[model samples]
Target: MNYSPELVQFLGSLVAILAVAGLAWWMKLGGAPELSNEKEAQAAASEAMDGFESVETAVDANGRGAILRDRSGCLLLLKQHGNKFAGRLLTHSATGRIDKDKLVVDSGERRFGVVALAIDHAQSWADRINEVRSASDA
Candidate 1:
């Protein structure tokens, strides 16, 4: 059977699109990652950054994110970035506020923006974040 040039071009484009989509699905390149437990959060944090050892971890109630604390009392925020997770070491400049069970944190990097996590003891985490700021000022 003979086909027109336009028909051939359309088929070629369709194949390319399907191939790309298949590759993305196979690689899990666009799924929302969640932390199912403290161990998983710690692992993701360590993978996102070098030399991060989480001594304490608080996974979000819904598993949307987590807050990890290293032995040195440094806080790390782990959140979904595309299909993977991104960890940001909460600097002294980082700040957080609590709303009952919710803790909203600002990384202080304008681009990184803010994140609100629902975890146990949100008030304590917010207080701990404040201590980070105070310690820096001291």
Candidate 2:
């Protein structure tokens, strides 16, 4: 079959574009990194939750998001979406509980998302959040 030059060029460009797109998806080019250290986790938290004056404690949720408590008894949930971070401030009414290895933060009416960190200290985060929540109540 004889192929026109225009068709050939168009096919080549399409293939190139597909290849680039595949590479980006494979490498997660604009995704959040799996935080392995406190500093990196803090940076991700800061980027995800702006205006966080100071971070008292932080935990990574398998690179998906972070559970952070600020100095002022604020529980912040930072979820990474593509290259951007979506943040939610868990109010004092929000209750925290651990189901298996995941810490579920929920309120009576609405529920916040869950963070699945590979760390072994899921309970620690839940406890801290509960402590802060209770403190604010008192």
| Candidate of highest lDDT | 1
Residue 89, model 2: lDDT of 71
Estimate the lDDT of model 2.
0.66
Computed on alpha carbons, the lDDT of every model, listed in order, comes to 0.87, 0.66
Model 2 RMSD, rounded to 1 decimal: 6.7
Q: lDDT tens string, model 2, 17-131?
A: 9999999999878865455566665676677667675465455546666677777767777656656666667766666677876776653334344544444477777786677
Give per-residue CA lDDT, model 1, range 13-108, as digits (tens).
Answer: 999999999998998777777789998988898897888998989998878789999988889998777768887988888999976669999988
TM-score for each candidate, following the candidate numbering: 0.77, 0.56
Q: After superposition, how far is residue 90 of candidate 2 from its true place, in Å?
A: 1.3
Which residue pairs show collisions in model 2? none
Residue pair clashes in candidate 1: none
Residue-level lDDT for 126 in candidate 1: 87
